[model samples]
Target: MKSLIVVDCQYDFIDGTLACENAENAVNSIIKYINSNDIKVHYSKDWHSIHNGSFKDNGGVWPVHCVQGERGARLHEDFYKHVEKDVKRPKEDNVFYKGIDDEVEEYSAYNAENSQKLSLKDALEDEVIVAGIASEYCVRETVLELLEAGHMVEILKDGLGYVDSEDHLKNLQDLMERGVRII
Candidate 1:
């Protein structure tokens, strides 16, 4: 079965505190692609707690963002609208949340679980088309995890962003070397 793994395209990753470079530009294309596809769509949220080491100020690597119930944690409005409208099918229960733990950080959506405790690896059958913010971060981590789980992952190149250009290219190279296909 085909699945579209949409990583954190939330406000915090796009235009909020931890915004990625050019992340905003991918919105329309992502929306069009999701609405036009017939396969299952998986949306991942970086639902965090109020305090965590994931924030630089707290001694973690990243800035503070995506706290649960916060505005920054919400998905980009337009992209989320597509999820709300399209993820209603009985077989379409793929919206998962990650990065919620205050102690250990989980960048991959596969690390998160649905209400039923199903991870993406459990929910997905075969192939996945990836799209989301920060190509060098959450999106990259999720794709690597999916690939390790034996899923065929094809990243939508134009639909991703990165905080650092050089690291972005390096990460893409790493994915390609690991048999991930870029579209």
Candidate 2:
């Protein structure tokens, strides 16, 4: 079975704090892809608490964003709408929330879990396609984790957002060299 992993397509990474370049376009492309595909879809979100170590307020490098229950933590409106409209979609049950622990700066969705306590790694199939925000960070880390776990991973090239275009391209190249297929 092949699975689609939508990584961190949240408001904070789009238009709020830590917004990335081309995030809007990436999100639109992701929505289109989801609408066009019949594959199983999973979403990863940064559901951080106020005390999450990744926040600047907590002595981390990033500004406070994606705090649980906050607007910035919510998925893109259009994406969420599509998820709601599609009965075939598993809705929030397929959402994997990472960065929930206050002390950890979790970047990989592989470390996330759904409300039912199912980890994304456990829920994923052998073949996975990944798309979404901050290509140099969360998306890249997740792809690496997936690869390390022996899954056949594909990256949606046009469906990626990033903080730096050069870094994004470099990461793509590095990932490709590591056997990740960029599509």
Top-scoring candidate (lDDT)? 2
* Candidate 1 ranges with C-alpha deviation above 4 Å: 82-85, 88-92
What is the C-alpha lDDT profile of model 1 across 1-183, one tens digit per residue? 588877888889888898888787766667777767777777788888878878887889888899888999987888645544546322325668787678898888877776676776777759998888889888988898888888888998888878898998899999999998988
Q: Write one digit per residue (lDDT tens) for candidate 2, span 90-125.
A: 466798999988888789999799999999999888
Best candidate according to TM-score = 2
* CA lDDT scores, all candidates in order: 0.80, 0.89
- Provide TM-scores for the models: 0.90, 0.95
Which 10 consecutive residues of model 1 have the lowest summed lDDT?
83-92
lDDT of residue 165 for candidate 1: 80
Q: Which stretches of model 2 miss by more than 4 angstroms?
A: 83-90
Candidate 1 accuracy as lDDT? 0.80
Error of 2 at 130 (Å): 0.5
Error (Å) of candidate 1 at residue 76 is: 0.8
